[model samples]
Each structure stands twice: as C-alpha cells, then as structure tokens.
Target: MATGSRTLWKGAITFGLVHIPVGLHTAASEQGVDFDWLDKRSMDPVGYKRINKRTGKEIDKDNIVKGVEYEDGKYVVISPDEIEAVFPKTTQTISIERFIGANELPFVFLERPYYVAPINKSDRVYALLRETLASTGKIGLAKVVIATKQHLAALVPSGPALVLSLLRWGDEVKTLDALELPPAGRGNVSAAELKMARQLVEEMSGPWDPADFKDEFRIQVMKLVEKKAKAGEGQTVLQPEEDAPAHTGEVIDLTALLQRSLKGGGKPARKTPAKKAGAKEPASKPATQKKAA
Candidate 1:
C-alpha cells in the first residue's frame, strides 16, 4: 500500500463460517492527459451548463428531473425517492460464493481492483485466508456491494496483500463467436517451427517486473507541458480551489535470427516443454465456468 492511501470501503469478508474485517483501498490510478476546455479569447476556463434542448435556454437545477424514454419523444419521469427504493442495500460485506483456480478467470472479465487490508484486529484470520488461497493456487469468487452498486469480484492473494478485483458482469463481455479467428491447435504449424518459437520465447522470458515498464505517452506529454510552461506559453485561469488527485500467442520460425536465438541460449525452461511425451489431449470444456446467477 502507498503512504497516505485512504480506505474507500470498510467491510468484512465472509466465507463459510469465517469473517474477517477489512478495508478496501484503490489499487490503480489514471495516467492520461487532462485537457480542460478553455475560452481562447479571455484565457478563461470553460465549464458545462445545462440547457433546454428544445428551448435553447438555461434551466434552474431545481427544475431538472430524471426520466426514462419509452417512446420516441415520450419520457417517464422518475423521482429521487423512487430510485432510492430500488438501489441495492450496502451490506458492507464481501460474500465469497466459492473458490476456483486463479487461471480460471478470463482476462476480459477483469475490471477495476482494490487492495484489501485487514482491520479491527482481524489480521490473523486475514493472513490465514490469504495464505490458504496462495498455497492452493485458488481465488475466491465473491460478490460485494460498493457505493450502493452490487459488483462481482475476485478475492486474490497478491504477495502479502489480498486484492479485491471487481469483475465485469457476465453479460457485459461479448462472446468470441463474433470473431473470425483461426481454430485452436497445431493448425498448419510444423513441429520444428513450434520448437524454434518455444526457444525464442525462452530467450525473451524474464521475471515479471512492473517497474521495468512505464507510461511513456503520459511522461512525454507532461514533459511538453513543462517545456511550454518554461517558455511562458502557459496561461493562468481563475477557478475555485479544490483538492483532488486522480497478449497474443503466436509461433513462426523462418530466419537465421531465430537460429541465433536458439544458439545464444537463455534461461533454462521453467515451464513444461511445448510437446511432452504421452501428454493427454486438453479438455474441450473450460476448467471452470462463471457461477450462475
């Protein structure tokens, strides 16, 4: 956890008969350019305002209402009280429904993540749960309500911390049936090519170090902004002061470069060979499926 990180949600993780109190802190941050709309003439900041679509006039905030359109130009107004009646209750508990292999989750289903830290003298139980999941190579499939919205999440043991990664709803991810991809298998690839590809992968394989990579685009943009500011090209706009902060797999072998890669030698293979003797065919069905609602 980073210094001064605030806990966004305080809750208890419940599975079976065990309960561990914990706090959820944000795990990631946006690193994109923040471009504000500005008035070019006076160097003032431009802000959004609500205007009547038909009358082309500004309306008071009190007069605005929420509505759902059922017909072309017809709307059914919904009141704040009515919306509140249907919102999911904040349970303040992450209910683990079941456990599954960590690899069972598809990458497309992953959404946002939050760091889970033990709280209220629950450290022992929290450590127990984390170590159990890590040793078993499994993750807890859980459902939690955050900010009044119910979310599907995975309780994963990441090093010394437990991470609650929110997952996309099953219906939110599109099926691959729409894609025109090649069928999975050997599919016209030769054994020699596979061997060379494996060798190339071995040559490139290294330990995962996130610090090795960075947001170059954001860095460069900030650099340009700094350069412009130093050149007196920056403008000062009036505003209210507020505190705020914010893989493909393929195999092909052709050239001598690949031969050199094979000959240059790399770290000894950590994974099973590409082709194992008497290996059984992989199961057609996925090892695990998303739990039904």
Candidate 2:
C-alpha cells in the first residue's frame, strides 16, 4: 500500500552498533465529520476565547504559564525554560532497549501506529531487521520522542513495512483493582452448553476479511449531505428505519442460545465411531445342535 508523502518524524533505529536512518509516516487518518459552531442569528462561525475560569476575564497569550497541582487548591508555576530543560533530548534516534514477544504486550498499552521506512541507503539493514523480528515473532520496545513528547513504542514488522506503534507508559495505565471482577473459571457454564457453543463458533468461523466491513453511518451521512446540496434548499428527508431490539432478558438459556446460533438450528449430537468392515463376530455355540441330534 502506498503511504502518504507527509513524513511526521525523522529518526533512526539504533541498536547495539546498527543504526538505520528512517522516517515515520502516519499509518491511519482521522475520519470524523467536520462541523462548525455557528451563531444562530448571523450564521457566522463562533470562535472560542481563552478566559480565566476564576475571574471570568479574557486572558492574554503572554500571561499564560504552565503549572502543576502539588496539593488541593495549590499549584506550582513552571517556566518554559524549566520545562525545556527537562524535555527529552531530540537525538533523532529510536534507541531500542529490548526485544519481546509481540503477544506479551496487552492491547490497552498500544496507542497510535505509524509506518516507518528507511531514509537514505539503509534498506539492507532495514530488511534484515524486519525479517529477523518477523521470523522470531518478536517486536522491539523502545522509548522515542515524537512531536516534543516522549512515548514508549513497539517496533513491529507488518508485512513489507516496519510499523512503529506508540504505547502508553506503565504508570499511565490505570489498575483494575478498584472494579469488582469475577475469577476466571466455568461460571454457570455446563459442559454440554460449552460444547454446543464451540460447535456454533466453529460453524460460524471464517477468514478475517477487512474489505467485508464498512462505515455505513458515514456513507449515509455523506449521501444525505449530497442530496441536500443538490436540492438547494432545506427539505425534510425520511430517516432510516431502526432495527428491532435484541433480546436482553436477565434470565438466559445458554442451551437455546447455542442451538439457535448454529445455523438457526440445533447442532447434531456426537455419535459413536462406526465399526470396521469385515470384523469377525463371536462364534455360535455347537452344544445345542448336538443335543438335538
């Protein structure tokens, strides 16, 4: 796939002694519908203004300062020079610290993804790194500074490209200790029901084809916008019909659900293996014939 020409960041991948110059290109783009706030009377676009929340007064750009809340109702003012001093050095390098199994990292840690490619004449080293990582099923974990912010990133080999996925630091992720969660086990699930569920899953299983899915809402919205533009006037349009509600009852019948899920019918029960052909039968007794004679 062709990546956009815009290069977001310029850097190099650095390991022990290997250094490969590279650049980061955004892998994904925002798909949100753009909207503007307009004044009701004049139909003019409304703009936002920065103001002091306490005094409700408009604040000037030069008066703004960065501060950190040290305690309740107390903030420590920090100067721009002080923040700049603490910023991570722009080394123009993605220094990989270690390699770990790609599956070891949880999905929650992953943030944004970018396509990384060799800059000048580092194609050979880049290919070597990509192949090595792909063969080993491992990804490089490194700390990189992008857009003046430090981020933990995972260097993943995705097809013919090296994908640099930004990750949240360990401390940035919140712990799940507060929420009450049940222990992992067979929770009210019977063996027969579980077997049927597995059968249903097997019956419904298919290949992962992203092309089959689409953003239907976006498509409809664009169509509506075009229709309105062509009409040249505000006109009433019929809304799409809502889908029927799904069953969400508290009492659930797992057996019925599993049965209905499998092609809208119950799956056939397991059967015993058929006996081999030409198998010898037990010999008939000869004593009864001798008594009759």
**What's the lDDT for candidate 2?**
0.56
Model 2 stretches astray by more than 4 angstroms:
1-63, 228-293
Candidate 1 has an lDDT of 0.59
Q: With candidate 2 superimposed using the best TM-score fit, by how many Å does residue 283's alpha carbon deviate from the native?
A: 86
State the lDDT at 191 in candidate 2. 98
lDDT of 1 by residue, 47-143 (tens): 4464555455565555666655556545556667987887676545566666789999998778888777654344555676688789999888877
RMSD of 2: 30.6
